[model samples]
Target: MSLNFDPQWLSRYPAQEPVGGAVSSCVFCGIACGDVEAHVLAETADTLCFLDHLPATYGHVLVVPKQHFQDLLDIPEESFQHVMATAKQVANALRDSCGASGINLVHATGQAAHQTVFHFHVHVVPRYDGDSIVVFPRLADPTRKHEVAQRLRTALNAPQPPKTEAESSQA
Candidate 1:
């Protein structure tokens, strides 16, 4: 079976720098550092919330850590918590201001998850009735629920590995 694929497809997206290291080429890092212009919404010492230029909805907002982190796994626990708090605040504001009935807090981690930006960010998408935006369209396989749960439980209960030098330094 020949699959039509382009190995260089990732090159079309922005270059990703190392975790915890800020690079000029990273647009999110630039925005967080005040080097790039973005529609500012809320700013805290550890996080920044801004309007997405290409919004999924009318009041789409992005909450990100000021310090560069490639994705969820790379971000420190404290920083990730702060980002989540800021995202909660943004979500509330979006719901209240936009009169949205519901909100979707999305955080895509890698290329397979459609995360275009390398920075760790949570997209606060305000939703209304019949918006036609389908984030998760997959039907659940009820038979595999217990099997999946057990796998997840096992992984969650497993002992955590020691952090590397770079990871320790970041913390």
Candidate 2:
């Protein structure tokens, strides 16, 4: 399916401009632009899916937007939705083709969260029985659970600030 994106969306993000044929600093952008070689699985109007070079599992794949977006916050809502829809299709293919018992959709946003690549992408990992990958190892503390929930709820209930002129123009 084709993506419905604002024509001026790329103009709003100056850093997304390509150098030569690709965004020089971001490898994912190069792949998307066909400047870099990758074992591509699928491609859509707004997204690309390919095998991970350093896969955690045999059929591990990455689903990314064709345009350059550094992180989750930088991606436009329409582009992000297309990426997710593509990821879901990839997950199903992995399970059917790779004989995976389960699937894990992993997305890391920042350095502290173990995001090595700056580009906005989702890792579609196929999980088999007895796999050694430990996605989440931290234990939750029950004592502060109520306080944490309240804090998150308060933030969710807060009204968003009005967009500036620059932001409105981009939209």
Candidate 3:
């Protein structure tokens, strides 16, 4: 058993700390802490909006909490609400500035949900008419929609799963 936290020493002993699916050396966390550089757009007490390093469109933005929330599941409701509001602002700025055809606020929660970045962030992707990117292709109606909706509605109406101590305190 040994301890190694040297950033430069990572080349010799590559390792990482995983905290509830969150990487301690997360790039977004560095950016949040001002340890990394980013083209900042807007910042609030709880959230930060910035241009995506790899833009899907011209004004693609990423809205994230200043705190290191691993994903949507880890963020508090108030922080999540603020993040959504910041995303909306970014979307409106994109639309008003460039007359965007549409905008997609994408939040990939878990690894299974295609979340590459462990940090909780909403991608404000702007859409333009005739843009090469196919935001959403037309798809045939799903089978058993009504049946699934009824099942989901019934599930939604059922009592929620018991909360943990942390969640109960959050409430």
Candidate 4:
């Protein structure tokens, strides 16, 4: 190996998938089951958080439920709360320790929506000004949002999806 350093050297290295040669069939399941190696930051009865192997930004973290759930549609109330609370804790640390200007608490549900991993996980991405990365997220226009709202409202009434922590606790 040459002693000379190149800032672009890291880019030349191919990204490793889910920490490489995971023991379980499902990568995240391997992590959750402690069959895969990771720099685990936090672990709770229902959740586990660790640094991303291929981070989108500095201090990027992936928070996941220890119990397997492919997507948001089936996550139970308590498990969901554990993931959300853990994400909040990681986000605050990024702001306080890493000087993040903002944060994106991102979750993708399906493959078409860009959910690459089938296991449910939340990305607590830290952002800084002048940073090239963008989640490219936007909100619906308030005027037109009612159309979207009505569609969700109808779906909300019908059920295959379960309730969230707040929803279940309130009932």
| C-alpha TM-score for every candidate | 0.81, 0.82, 0.79, 0.71
8-34, model 3: which lDDT tens digit per residue?
312442223335755557878888878
Task: Show the colliding residue pairs in model 1.
Answer: none
Model 4 bad stretches (over 4 Å): 1-24, 137-146, 157-171
Best by lDDT: 1
RMSD of each: 4.7, 11.2, 9.6, 9.3
Candidate with the greatest TM-score versus the true structure? 2
Whole-model lDDT, candidate 3?
Answer: 0.79
Ten consecutive residues with minimal summed lDDT in candidate 3?
6-15
Candidate 1 residue-wise lDDT, 81-133, digit = tens: 99999988987887778898899999978777667788889989999999988
Which has the higher TM-score value, candidate number 2 or candidate number 4? Answer: 2
Assess candidate 4 and give its TM-score to the true structure: 0.71
| Cα lDDT, model 2, residue 77 | 87
In candidate 1, which residue ranges exceed 4 Å CA deviation? Answer: 1-22, 162-171
TM-score of 1: 0.81
